[model samples]
Target: MDSLKDVTLRPWPAPKKEELSQEDLLVKIEQLASERGHLRDITEKSLQEDIDAGKHIPDDTNDAVKQEAKEKEAPSRQERLEKVFNAGKEMYGHLEWAKFAATNALDLLSLVLSQDTNKRNLSTFSQTFREQGLNQGIPFGSFGISKENHEFHNRKPEELQRIQELEHKQKVVAQGARMEALDSAVDEILQAAKQLEKEVRRQTKYWQEIVAVSDQGWPLQRLRQNARHVPFGVRYGLPEAGDHFKARGFAPLQMDKDGSIILDPALALKPKTFRVRVSIDGKITGTSQLEVEVDTKDHSIQKSIQLARDSLFEEELYHEMSLETRQLLAYGVEFRDSVISVDAPLMGSTSHDRKLLIDCIPREDIVADSHHHEHDWLARNVAEALRLLLAHEHSMRLYRRSQSPPPLTARTQEQAPPPLLRTLLAVFRHLEGVDSLYVCLEMVANTLNSAGLEVTLDTTRETSWAILAESLKEPSKRGLSATDQLLEIFRKPFDGRATLTLPTSNGVQFESLTIVTRTIIGQPTFGTEHKLTLPSSLTSDLHLFQQLKFSSVKEVTSYLDWILPLHIAHRLLKSEYSSRATIKSHDSGITISSRECKRGSAFSTDIKVELLEGKLKATALTASPLSETEHTEQSHTWNGGHSSTSFKQVIQNWVG
Candidate 1:
């Protein structure tokens, strides 16, 4: 709690000096004058070259005669030096008074310090004299004033030391006070910052709640929750918006439980004329004046009321409203005429208009989701409905504002929309048709661009379908009907059945089928014929096979690496066959052979697969037909193919 006023110390007083005799003073003055004169001489000499340069005038007249005349008029070097000396003498005389004044001031200061009682003053005076005396060539040490005499005139050493100790203590106290004040200030600042942070967080949370309500649309419970949290100053006190409805030429008596605004039957019995104004928030947005004649027995007014209400609160219609319209709805709705006025905020508006219509109608009404058949029509029309709802709400707000009493002061111009409202409207315009499939396709195109794929939706779709059509078994047909046919395009060769076409050495094409079979009753068996044909020159070239295309080699090697172990394990576990499968790759071909023993009936299959002129060739040795047991096993394996598991394993291995 130390105050800033307590942090300052008293200022030190000026020192006194000893008096000098008149003769000595005069001598000192003369010596100082001589020293100043010498200094003046040095300064003048330093500026001599500049002074000479300034005096020189260049000759412009024709050479010989003009040069000779200029030389005669100019002063000689010796004469110029004499003129400079004379000028220096005049300037020295002018400065002599100033020099004398400075000398006398120093003498006066020394005299005052000599008699000063303050020790600090006396010491400062002595130090100043010592420094200046050395600089000016004056004998301050020879002044004949002893330290003892000087000390006796001022404070004693012990007294001066005590004064110094007291001053030090005061300084320490002042510094401590200053530090305490600074600490207190910093603490206050921190507390203020913390309070400011809390206020910011509270405001942020409040705004977040408002935004959530606006975005989600206000349900009854949510509206109530919002009301509870709203500051008292901003809370609207009118009955919920759902309690009222507006119709031309009819005054609403009450709202039914189903949300229809029931008009007075008496008023509706005869011809009547009325004007209606609707407002949302505090602004008038719409007005209608009408004349109506209805039969009391027919309940035509109620029917008209229900129809008007239905048009106002339709869900499909609501979705099509623009941001400006939605903002109006948010402000609430108002209905007014000469005899009656009603106001309803949008927060309490409900989607029960259809139910209300049905309750008031004579016959049952069928409610449909949408009137449009095309998917795009529904999307586009839904947006239009929202815009309409917003526009109606805005009209209601305007009508309400117009009905209120005029203020004492009038505004020169209408207020512009708030910045938040303007921003929301801009966003709505930007995403106007976002629900349409075309817009969705555009969004997808943007996604593809973001992911480093340079593709547009139309181009991508066309290319994909073209590729699919080409791969189909019935390429002539325009439609793909089977799921398996679509899935076949993505299938790989390792799933146990692969049909490969290869050209023979004579240039004729042949087909080879590789089939793997496994069954519960017997060992798994794999059979394939690989026909390998190499060009005559490359028949002995082993390097060609070793340096095959990396991707193709990897596919073949991986398939073998995974399938060989599974085949061996299945044979060993069933105890029906002890099989040895050998796979070797050479320059001309890849050779695969499997020898198995099942119930002492031995069988062997050898396949040679080769790469010849960038085409795969497979050759298989002729083998006997499979017996009943083999056929049943093959059929069971084919029926329960492990496509999904094999595909997953292949993907995992490739990724690793």
Candidate 2:
């Protein structure tokens, strides 16, 4: 019995969610929503049910409950009641009974009435207003007059039927046109599906072939500026070039209609190789033919990549040497007509001059000489070394890049290319000098050994190459690779050494002599130099303390030719004579004197000993006081390589 204003409304309790993490808050909120039904789900029916259940009823718990109880007890006044007003007859009712009675009365009237039209003048039926219009156009209030014509407004039934027939024909034409448009749309969809399928097939084939190429270890990269037919590029050229070359090292792999990769212009080009011919005295002693292994079918992707790689290396090698030729012109290295000619003088032969004839020829052009030349190995080695050096140059390029870069500057400095020709020339000069010296020393050592003198000799072509193994075992602090270090030696001066047993230094003594040869292509000290360092014992014996320097192998051998025999005579022969030998000229001569007395006569023998050209020579004079006929002279020559030839045997007969 509460009035509307006096009935106090109770508000629902909200969930308490403070000091909770988002996860905990979400869990707490969901738990609360499930425990207590949502406010939005509370309906009047639920509220009335709660009210009927005696919830929210006033007890003396708080002021809110006391106020609620007071309002419920005091709300006996009627307020805001429904069904207090009645419906009016003007706007609220439709007189269905009256309308039915009127309709029946009208129908009864029509059954007896006659209809008439102005078209037929009169008819036996009640008049119908179906063909009549009450519209008077303008000046008739509250309605607009249409200026346009209407189909059935003022027209007869026959005219309306004719218009309907014409509309039906027009509808048929429009339907036909709509069907044609739908057919065109369907054809377009089919064509688009076929085109998409073809494109898919093309894409699949292209990527498959690209994957195959990738599996072969070729580097592939996406193009920065995409080409029309090319999306990716293959890098088959040398990686050490690092864009240093003016031409790029990669080429776009274009797709053809069949989804095969098209060979770029770089790959389509022919390959080349070096033809290093060893020419001696104007004759080809040896020739190298570098043949490429390729498939007969050009469709092979591997073949194309191989050709491109070979062409890149061969072209770069030739170009580098061509540029190097400018600086090596003084060293007899000339590049003319794509050919490099290097002067390689022989060891002992002064008449015939050897030359290394290098030509950058196409692989197809080298027709493998019909006959194998005597120095075929030499020519092939030269070519191989040249190629290896180029590869080494590529490695050096990478090494240089790995180092810290210089500060950026506006003043650009032009860098010279790798010294390929200079290295080749330096190696040639160094080897030539050292080999000649070794050959001479070997010949002398053999001759001395044949004379029953203990002598041996050994030499190396280059010291750096000799110790390359030891150098590679340890890591370099400077971050230089062993191969780079090895290749780097060729760019600088070359050093070679040979050790030989000094003359008369038997196996019991380890006294030896050393010869160091050095060569450079250019600068303060040009060409090859040979320096001789004799053993300390031999140096003191021969009054020679300083190292001997020679500009030519001929000069070195000539000097050795004179010094070896002098050491043998001054030290070996003089000591062999015991107390009987007198050293009057210890430099190169020895004298041995002997005297004997018998009962009837006196005998005396005097011998002069000398060594020349690594051989022993002795001359003896015999005389007796008994007669002039006793005066006799005998000479003995002891050359090497003969057991019967002995200086002792000849000197003994002269004394007896």
Candidate 1 local lDDT, 98-214, one digit each (tens): 777776676556654544445223343445555675446763333334443222256689999999999999999999999999999999999999988876776665555444433
Q: How does candidate 2 score on lDDT?
A: 0.71
Local distance difference test, per candidate?
0.35, 0.71
Q: What TM-score, over all chains together, does every model reach?
A: 0.16, 0.66
Residues 1-656, model 2: lDDT tens digits: 22443666775655565355679868866755553434345678976887898775543465677688888876433432322222234213336556656765554344333222232222321233212211222111222233653334477899999999999999999999999999999999999999989888988999998999999999898886756569889988777763544255678899998788988887777677767888777878788876555553544876788777876787787778887788877788877776889887776578897898887777767455564489889888877788888888888777778898999999997878777777777877787788777877766776666556677788888887888788778756377777677777678788888988764533476678888888887775688888889887777767886698888888888777667766665677666656666667644555555544555565555566555454555666666567757767777655565656444455556654
Span of 10 residues, lowest total lDDT, candidate 2: 133-142
Candidate 2: segments with Cα more than 4 A from true spot: 1-173, 242-246, 292-295, 366-373, 405-414, 477-493, 503-510, 575-587, 596-639, 647-656
Model 2 lDDT at residue 47 = 67
